[model samples]
Target: MTNQNILAVDDATDRPRISVIGTGYLGATHAAAMAEMGFDVVGVDQDPRKVEALSAGRVPFFEPGLPELIEKHVATGRLRFTTDIAEATAVSDVHFICVGTPQQATSFAANLSYVEDATAAVAKNLTHPGLIVGKSTVPVGTAARLRLLVARHVPAGVGVELIWNPEFLREGKAVDDTLSPDRIVLGGASPAAEATMRELYALPIAAGAPVITCDLPTAELVKVSANAFLATKISFINAIAEVCEAAGADVSVLADALGHDVRIGRQFLNAGLGFGGGCLPKDIRALMHRSKELGAHQAAGLMQQVDEINMAQRQSVIDKTVVAAGGSVLNKRIGVLGVAFKPFTDDVRDSPALNVAAALHLRGAQVTVHDPEANGTARANFPTLSYASNPLDAAIGASALLVLTEWPELVDVSPESLGEIVENRVVIDARNCLDPERWAAAGWRVVSLGKETVVPAPAVRVAALV
Candidate 1:
């Protein structure tokens, strides 16, 4: 008969009625995940086409297990899609705002126009007041501001709680990470709101995932701090790589040795091409920008080095290319493999691989690039770069091959076949993702970061006795 019991009704009603807003990569994936966990989820989006696609068991992008998950849920009547915001608000007690908040131009602050619009829409149509949780990454003070807005607009004496539960899903492994998260974080002003969160993620928590609870500010910080730490880890290795390059040492070996220590167990210490994708690079810069505006100039200054190191790593790749291409890229045929910043994701935002590709083209090299999942997105960004269907096709008649992104396909490429296609067998492994011995044995000259060029053993000739 009370509001708490009203929200609790979904528990006994055979699968909780759930609604996820803004069904892009994050939302669509989360919606599918809730359904997989036996929740009756209604996925809502402003775009009728996207809603229709999900309703008909279609996924807009290329996630490995997403389409099948959506299909499985839709068949069981436990999942559905909707373009009507009010209908979703009416049926679901928990509405997740999963919209994007990209950085605003002319400043370092996050652009929350989309977040505001999505939040206001959810506020206007409240059937029975429950919880409105934010899963979007945003500026530190956003949840508090949104909480105030919800209170101002909600019906008199109606109980609607706002919670901040930031998402930590990596682009490629979103589904697995969602279903079996290493940790669950919930932040809100009310204990009741936190209880609902615990219930929602109860399965993961019971399965031995650590659940951390705090107020709004601490939860907002956990997301940004985690990103900042990852950025620092990457830059730290790249900085060492610079020293190795100057001192004639192998960074790959140094990384391996250093990684053996328990403190630095080598998750993000890749020595080549730096960090990128949808997060990392942008998030750190934005956090620094926000700190400076908050008068924390000293903290902002430290991140300046992190930013400098990542940017410099990209330039280092370009510099290596110029040196490898006979001291210039002037009219040389250059091949670029893997345009996605990292492997297994189609997102190309601030991607170092594409940046290198564009830079190589600017330096007058006839650049040809290829990636399995990212070529379409890459072409949209850099239409001038000649894109090929596969890695071998990209190297056809090229003077130099630049391994920019570390897709697994690049490893299995036959070095002998590549030798026959190029003007000379030379490769710059910017990612250090290839084996030096294999490529060298195929008579291809292999150049890589923080190490000397390797010379393969010559083929033994059998002398004929006449």
Candidate 2:
């Protein structure tokens, strides 16, 4: 069937009305972007609090530029939030499932119950011909299973087609990524669905975003595979970082030289606290779990090692902090900077920086943490640890300061000023973001990963002439 027949709507422009299910990070961004593209968008979620917040032009989480965009659309009346699935299905022509498929509590495999529930809800609530788009990252073959589930749930004689259009959003740049993605992937899209999607994404396509159309399984694999490859690249450099430290070489310099090679781009080559957040860690583990299930043993093992190396970097940071704190952190004042996983967003899920701080606190250190945008979120995650609003406050009376996340605010702090307040002028640059010379010149000892520690030379005592 042609998209015109499937997407019958009252608007004179005939644009497909959009309903994004599950208004977390992915869904909220997508719904707002669709509205920006001149499509009336409704975001559906079971959480009344989330709906109310979005309706009031307030975002529940921190993502750069998302709040302003949401506020603009909300004011223009092109976007809205609702908790009623039936109302959304009745009004919208395209339903996008952007729910979370987080790692299972007991296993590494993805917990797909949310995706299943969202799909079933959309399928059962259909009042007219509509298209279902899957934007959540899932295990391969999940699309086919969901297709069957949709078929069983939708009312008879209703035309409902499902497609997978995986989302690749960085936490900090989610707004820009959604509005102008690097590429668009459409999986298992029938000609009708593809046509509708092409029209729906007319803006990005016009602005030169490449689109790839493929079968369902390939589309499902694309998201996880991309995440896995990025995670592998990070782990690869971090593995080399261990070697760099042992060989008395610098990994940051090594990574710079390696990045000069076009084949190995320098994007994820930073050998620091490795990678953490909502996506990379869980996605890699889920990929490994799925690979093993599919009997791809070698692939699974590689991912296992990648995960191990990434996690090991966290312990490396904690160990370095202990050494910087005079062999132990017991009752020592440890100041931590940057808690959000990578920075620019207030998401602390599995944040390496926060992890290190919590570990230090557990070891009897008095921990004070700070972040540009994530202090509140970090406090929620690790409440027992003390939090400071600014970097200097975190450094007050600290025995050792650790820069975990590479936020510019933390990286660009004046070492001389920090020196005056810190009890012991020891700083561990776990992210390799701080300048060792600057800190050392300011009478501070700088310990960085993948490099030798830099310490200020002791002053010689002058003998009085008799």
Q: lDDT (CA) for every model shown?
A: 0.84, 0.92
**True-vs-predicted CA distance for residue 381, candidate 1, Å:** 1.7
What are the per-residue Cα lDDT tens digits for candidate 2 across 84-149? 999999999999999999999999999999999999999999888899999998999999999899
Candidate 1: give the clashing pairs.
Answer: none
Which pairs of residues clash in candidate 2, taking residues 3 or more apart in a chain or in different chains?
Answer: none
Index of the highest-lDDT prediction: 2
Name the top TM-score candidate.
Answer: 2
Q: How much RMSD separates candidate 2 from the native structure?
A: 1.7
In candidate 2, how many Å is residue 302 off?
A: 0.6
TM-score of each: 0.94, 0.97
Off by over 4 Å in 1: 1-15, 455-466
